[model samples]
Target: MFGPASSRSRSAWRPRPAPAARPGGVSPRSARRASGSEVRTPGSPPAGPAPRPALPRAAPPRAERTMPQLDSGGGGAGGGDDLGAPDELLAFQDEGEEQDDKSRDSAAGPERDLAELKSSLVNESEGAAGGAGVPGAGAGARGEAEVGAEVSAGPRPAPLARPPPPVPGWPRPALPVPWGTHPSDPSCPGPRAPRPSHPLWISPQALGREHASQRLFPDKLPESLEDGLKAPECASGMYKDTVYSAFNLLMHYPPPSGAGQHPQPQPPLHNKASQPAHSVPQLSPLYEHFSSPHPTPAPADISQKQGVHRPLQTPDLSGFYSLTSGSMGQLPHTVSWPSPPLYPLSPSCGYRQHFPAPTAAPGAPYPRFTHPSLMLGSGVPGHPAAIPHPAIVPPSGKQELQPYDRSLKTQAESKAEKEAKKPTIKKPLNAFMLYMKEMRAKVIAECTLKESAAINQILGRRWHALSREEQAKYYELARKERQLHMQLYPGWSARDNYGKKKRRSREKHQESNTGGKRNAFGTYPEKAAAPAQFLPMTVL
Candidate 1:
């Protein structure tokens, strides 16, 4: 059982009597205050708790400090001594701070001097050109020195405050303005026009980066092998048959070297090294003249068949016949062979000269030229055999058609040649095409249109509306593509890709000639289109 407040509980809760007062009737608190007044030798720290290291707090006004009066003479030795005591104690108390202040002042001495010099110069110029008009004035020098001394004695400008240390979780405040600007300056030319850049031309194949732009497309102009293979257009294949035909014609039967230069007639194609050994079943006699190494003379009975011939003379067999081949005995004393037919010379070569041919033996066939180089002519320069042969001959003074070969190569051969040729190089995209490639998808998304026709129409209008500089960018890109294409295919020509025309069949040709039905009026009739009539409807 616990006791009541008046009993043992009261004794337990009651405060103990205060400790007996110390000697001299002074309490602990009063003793502590008096301890500060006790003097200690300089350099030794104060007793008891060490003073907190002083922070750079602003000092009080100088007027508050009790200084020695100038008017009052030294009253007594004790008073004089005490007058300096307070000041000495204050200086000793802030010794560390004073040293710090001295160090900062020393560090900023040059900058402060420069600022003071500039200010003084500006002030002097504005107020009155101080001693400037005088030829030699020591007054200006004295003034400058005095101003400098005053400025140095005064407080130096506080160094610019640094940014506060970054807190762990908070974002940093905007960094201080660039060094050349003033504090809190907002107009620091923070926004600058972007520098213009020019793109370097690099082929798509050369690029190592794999991105959306480099993807292959069948309908798009090719930029790489993959793109080329993807493309469905084959320009080279379409033109291959025609181009090869023309090329073969030129190669097999080239024009004479010097047709009109000399009075001597040119040799026949039968003499050329390029002439074929055997005749093609489809080639006419005209074509056979170019292909056959040794062609048979035309029959003498046919008046339409004409040829060039020389007087009966011993044929030069020096290059063709070797003594070991036993061709010397077989050489005809006079060989009458049908040479290449003659035609009028060009306007530059004066007038036409007809060298009538003598009737030749129809069964005789000329020997093939033995050496390829000798095909040009005999060893002699001015010899008749030295003259180059004309590949073809026009009908003499008549526009009548002559029998000629339809095609040098068969359908199967042409098809095979086309299949064997390399894939054609794709044409480079133009400015508009390039622009469309880049912006088509963007437009499709914005317009929500999937149809290419509609998208292309919109893109085309936008392309025309683009600024000159914007369009120029695409043009430059296209130019770079073309340049790269040229570098890749130096020998390629646009003419090679010219498409071939389809040959008309005999039945189609007849149909084209008699295409429309004719009446007794002797005129073919054309159907007239009916005019449309818009029906009017009333709106409800």
Candidate 2:
């Protein structure tokens, strides 16, 4: 593989070689020195391949500022050549590198000042791997002979090159407890694992994508996101995309059918008026109010006692007598009722009040009124009837033929009335109430009979027999829970304040004391909750 000695006597298949050193043993670099008069031996190899062009001098390797003349890293591929570089060449490299250092230091001075920021949040003393040096600068790699720590004659080894820390000025994770510092892992510890870095928030686009996936694939997801999020919470968050319709990206539609159009795909016509008459209510709106996903998890008294369905029809109240004292004297046989039940008083009375009564004796069970419109008193501005609340009749529905009865109510009206009857203030639970509430479901689930009334009796007797200390503990828990409730529902005060005026007027006619005995604690029962406002509806 050397000069003319190699590949000179080639095989017939090989190309003829160009002659070298034709008149003298010379090459291009030395050709200038070779005169035409010079001669060469026939067997001598042509001058060795002309010296390869001197490589452009390499940029000096980065150096650390510490007291080392060598880097931990060795010369990468050509360690031997680096060791044998000429003395002058090595000296030149040293000069160049020193100049580069001066230039970089001077230039980076202003940049470093600008880079330094005041972030009190990040502790400076812990993990101090950044912010004091130029980027990409490091201890220059030198031969082992010049590595100060190992070499007897060399200068001291430089400080270890530090990695850049988390980019300055961006918030970093909360500082972790150092190894041997955490209280729980006290024994057999070396270095502690770094604390997990929880991002305060992800980018909106990424969050939105996750939310969309969860919304579209609620029960059967493509993949579980390992965000350490509480299970299934993001799946139905109130703030997540609430308006994902038929066109959102994650929502898929069926591919267009190629099976051809149906000849009679149109639906059959039905009487629209009767469609809702017997619809079974699509699992009842009551199911929506249940905390249990399945409606049957709790007793009927707990979940089904309120909001029970009522027929839409108004009841026959022709036999109902008014609640007024009989000594007021004989009243008229004909009275009136508000058609929409009642309306806020204004000029436009879309509904009229009328109820024709049957002939009545002086002491008839049904009472009459000359001014039933004013019977309840001045507070009620619209036509007043025997009813507490009346359903808004449809514009086209048949009118009720009977007199108004306070107990007669439609489903919607009954719901409104029940809400009205609820107490405005949340009654603080006693030990018994809390115990019963907690254990009621347990009893229902465990008992063979599963009768709510039977469960209630057992609970009542058990509660009476509970030790005072045990009861006190539960009572304290209930108090804390109630406090937490107030914290979570700060606006409950506003809900409790609703319908205060109506309550006052309704209570005005009642007696102060009941004939029944007070509770064992000598406390009176609480009054009803805030009344649900029965907003008047339009016929349309």
Candidate 3:
């Protein structure tokens, strides 16, 4: 038999022809080359492509016909020939893709229309409800209407073609809509197909750095139609009645009786930067809102045609609030009750000293700091001016003198004095002390123990049984307090606190000698009364 190596020797080399150039710029030779296909010389019949090595089995396709996709191009039961000409195959593939796109877009149409309908409904409700504006604030109301019109007038973006639909018979997942939205309602448009969620790709580090940046300003107030109407020019024309400057109205208005005061000519209503209608300038909501300027009449000229005494038929809301619906012609008016004088009126109240006349000084007066006594003093140099004495002996007089023995004790003092002056150190409370203090009243209330001595004995037993960790917690607290104590009272010793007790005891010992029973017989000059004879018999 031939040797195994000889039988397996490599086959002889074969040459491939260059592809022919065609009008379509594609050739059969190039197509086979691109597809990685091999062929024998032309004189020999070309062999059929060897059966493709079977691929690992895949799951079967869904039974129902739906959208087409790139992956299914070759795997389907029917397909364009694998060895077909490149240009023809490419043309077929393009047509298939276009058909899939059309089918997907048709399915997605209803969903887009639904979303737009919902947004429109929300904008309409907002416009209809209006804002916090009062009944007849037309400027504020008009602003809202314009905003709603713009929203309704906005152009919609074109719908894009989708790639493909999901496998048929799969359960679709639901998404949450914003509050008050009705997705499935027949009145609202339904989407042709579900829209896919697209996620944004932001760097986490960048997001964190932005979050760490310092806050530069407060959040701006939400803009509303009412916000733009705050400008005096916008609001000044709202009311039909005349509005007068309060100060001028009070000063220049004629009294109830006929008087001959000439009315002051009013200044023209000009939009001068020097003086604005409102004391504080109002911020405009948007630049465009004020594009058209209209004449804003001054408040004083608004209602000159209507006189003050005329009665109104409707409710009067001149006050900031509305009047209660009660009786007609019940206009609120000021009542005058004779009030007693705030201070008693006496004969001395008849006169007040008039202000001094101005001198011929050239400039405005500057305050003089000279004392009244200095102003009245004469040149006669007598005894030094009497020292000013205090009006009362105040408790703060002690502050004038240094507190006795208040300075920290010095080492130079004798041992006896130093020991006597040492400050008393209050014993720091341990965990047991705190526990007992808190529980003493509780124990009494619960009737667990009546006597404090019994409670103390039980508390001691419990404290001894406490775990090391529990005991350490309280010890740490006490240690902190001890450190604080040393800082506050650096030089104090025990003797200072106990010394007061010893001093009181010494004083009481000396006083004891003066307070005993008096002697029965008179020791000094005073004569004792003669002893009275006693009757022995007792009265029955």
Candidate 4:
């Protein structure tokens, strides 16, 4: 039984070994039974029953066998590769890379966006400020649109209205006058009636004879004249000359009362013999001077007596010769009469009488007065002797007198001298200058007193304590003050003098204090300067 048990144990162990082969391959008994004989082929190991096809790997649990999509696509390569990497881990790593890339992209994008935003904002700001269109609008396109719109709107305004052109060959139209009822009246004209060529109108009185006589002849009439008409010499032939002369004479010598009372009668022509002797043919003195013809004088005696010897009755003379009865005894009866000499009359006697003889020959022009009567005589009638009558003959016979013009010159010179010697009128003073002068006096007095006090303090009882140069400086300062005061109050000399005296006294005292310190040249030594370091940089 022991032997069989041992054999059985060996069989059991062999079987155990055989069972182990089952893992490697099918069991030998099963292989022999299946293959008919456990035959070995040449050069090859005996193949037992197909080694029980690897248990089909139990189809690896469905989830464990499937790898993530990454493993299939070249994800797992080496031993140390992340094959065990969880899907979440791989996804997390991928997500982390994506996040990093996104972060970089976000940062870069923000920068790019910020730059773009900044550029856009800058463009928008420029556009708003410049009144241009939005930034993206092309510049050339926008300008063209603006120009096209402006041109399409309207034509440009004209510069200004041109003045209406002047009418050809004609003046501006006359303003229309309103028509009245009277159509044919000259005063209510469409165009004003042409002004009369001679518009002057004369009054009836101005055309009368007495008015004419007064203007043409201002002096006394010739003694034997039949009628007083203007002398032929006085006629001004030219129209303008006549008008001017007539107007001037009318203005200067106005018509007298009753001058134009009667209309002048027409003149009749006279035979030569019928004409008055006093109207003997004469040439005007003016014509005689201009013409070559010599004037023939009338017989001297006949011409002299012609107008002068009017028949005077003795009774008319006796009326002016009345004398007092008591003065008759004093009158002498026999008056010596000088006899007339027989010599020929001198040529000078021609102008000696009250009237001059007519110098022109018969039928010549009438004579003009050498001096006009109005110019000769004073207008006053009475007191003729006091103011020299024009007819009075001077003893010397020469008409002009030396002292005549001298009187006006003497009077004017005297008046001018009197005016020159007159005292000057004082200008009126206002309160301001007076007040200013008073204030200036007070200031100057106070200043002088203060200066004296200062000098006195500096000198103490010893009045000559200061050096000459210091005295000069003090006096100069005082002088300047006085001068300033005088300038401020222009005419205040008294105050200025007082200040000057005070300054002078201070100067004298200073000179005395600096007792003649002599240098080698025998003059006072110059004063030494005080130490510069000790002095203040700025003066008070």
The best candidate in terms of lDDT: 1
Supply the TM-score for candidate 2.
Answer: 0.18
The per-residue C-alpha lDDT of model 1 at residue 102 equals 36
lDDT of 1 by residue, 319-362 (tens): 11212212222212111010112101222111111111111212
Candidates' lDDT values, in order? 0.23, 0.22, 0.20, 0.19
lDDT rank, highest first?
A: 1, 2, 3, 4
Instruction: Compare candidates 2 and 3 on lDDT and give the better one.
Output: 2
Put down candidate 3 lDDT per residue, 1-540, tens digits, no spaces: 111122111110011121111211222222222222211111111221111101001111211212111221233233321111111111111323334323432432322322232223211211222231211111131222112211121210101000012211110100011112123432111221121121111111111111111000001111231112111111111111101011111111111111112122111111111111111011000000111111121011111221111111111011211112231112111000001131111221100100111221124242232321121111111211210001111111121211222343355288866443332233333334544432333323222233454335323322322222223323322322222222222332232243243233323322343353223323421222111111000100
Q: What's the count of clashing pairs in each model shown?
A: 2, 7, 14, 7
Clashing pairs in 2: 63-138, 64-139, 68-158, 422-529, 423-528, 423-529, 424-529
RMSD of candidate 3 to the truth, in angstroms, is 46.9
lDDT of 4 at 215: 16
Q: 125-161 in candidate 4: lDDT tens per residue?
A: 0011121221211122212211111111121111000
lDDT of 2 by residue, 444-540 (tens): 4433224444445435433322322223334333332332223222233433433344344223312222223222222211234211111100100
Poorest stretch of ten by lDDT in candidate 1: 531-540
* Cα-lDDT of candidate 3: 0.20
TM-score for every candidate vs. truth? Answer: 0.18, 0.18, 0.16, 0.11
Alpha-carbon shift of residue 239 in model 3 (angstroms): 72
